[model samples]
Target: MKKIFFTLLFFGCCFLISAQTEPKVGDELIIEAQDGPTYHHIKFPKLNILVKRGKVANYKSVHGNVVIIDDVITDKDNNTYVVLKKKDGSKFFGYLTKVKANYEKSIASGEMVVKS
Candidate 1:
């Protein structure tokens, strides 16, 4: 029983790691939104964008080998914006509006200004 459990756990961990999408910096992706249906040309590994009622499907574009591990994004006064920082050191601020197919609508408003 112990051997079987260990083997299953190992395989499960391997499968999870393999299933992860490897996106590099400077890669551009054409993302199709599911609900509220908005098309966006997203550049990665730019910033981690939380799409409204949409799942991210990776598109084809340029690939870069540069790996960015720094997630710190601060302004002139040193204020952190989002969880993931803009990879290009640019600023972004807008109100994100989302509408679900089940007729459930949601909106998020905030301000973010990235500093050089």
Candidate 2:
């Protein structure tokens, strides 16, 4: 019985990992409003820079913005990065290249909803 339980747990963990969504270039997504003050790993540039540039770099302000996946980059360390841009043909407030994990987490948390 213990063997069976252990086997099931192992497979379940694998399934959960496999279920994580991966972002691709040119994917159209919309920013969904998140609760609380957390950005869910969606880190923007410094707050000072945002203020200096006359922009509010918070999740609430970014909610409902159309996000275009501009590029997918893999670094020498095998770390993956995603470039995000605005749909209106302009750069989003600041250059935010999300790490693969953070990008996937945002998707999983419904903070970044893929447009149909």
Among all candidates shown, the one with the greatest lDDT: 2
| Cα RMSDs, all models | 14.5, 5.2
Give the runs in model 2 whose Cα sits over 4 Å from its true position: 1-20, 74-80, 94-101
**lDDT digits (tens) for residues 1-116 of candidate 1:** 99999999999999997554233333222212223223122222222353432424332211221222233234586433223223444332222221111100100111111121
**Hey, what RMSD does candidate 1 come out at?**
14.5
lDDT of 2 at 76: 91
TM-scores for all predictions = 0.22, 0.59
Off by over 4 Å in 1: 21-116
- True lDDT of residue 29, candidate 2: 81
lDDT of 2 by residue, 1-116 (tens): 99999999999999987665566888888878878665655565656777778877554556798878778766697555567777876545655434232566677787777798
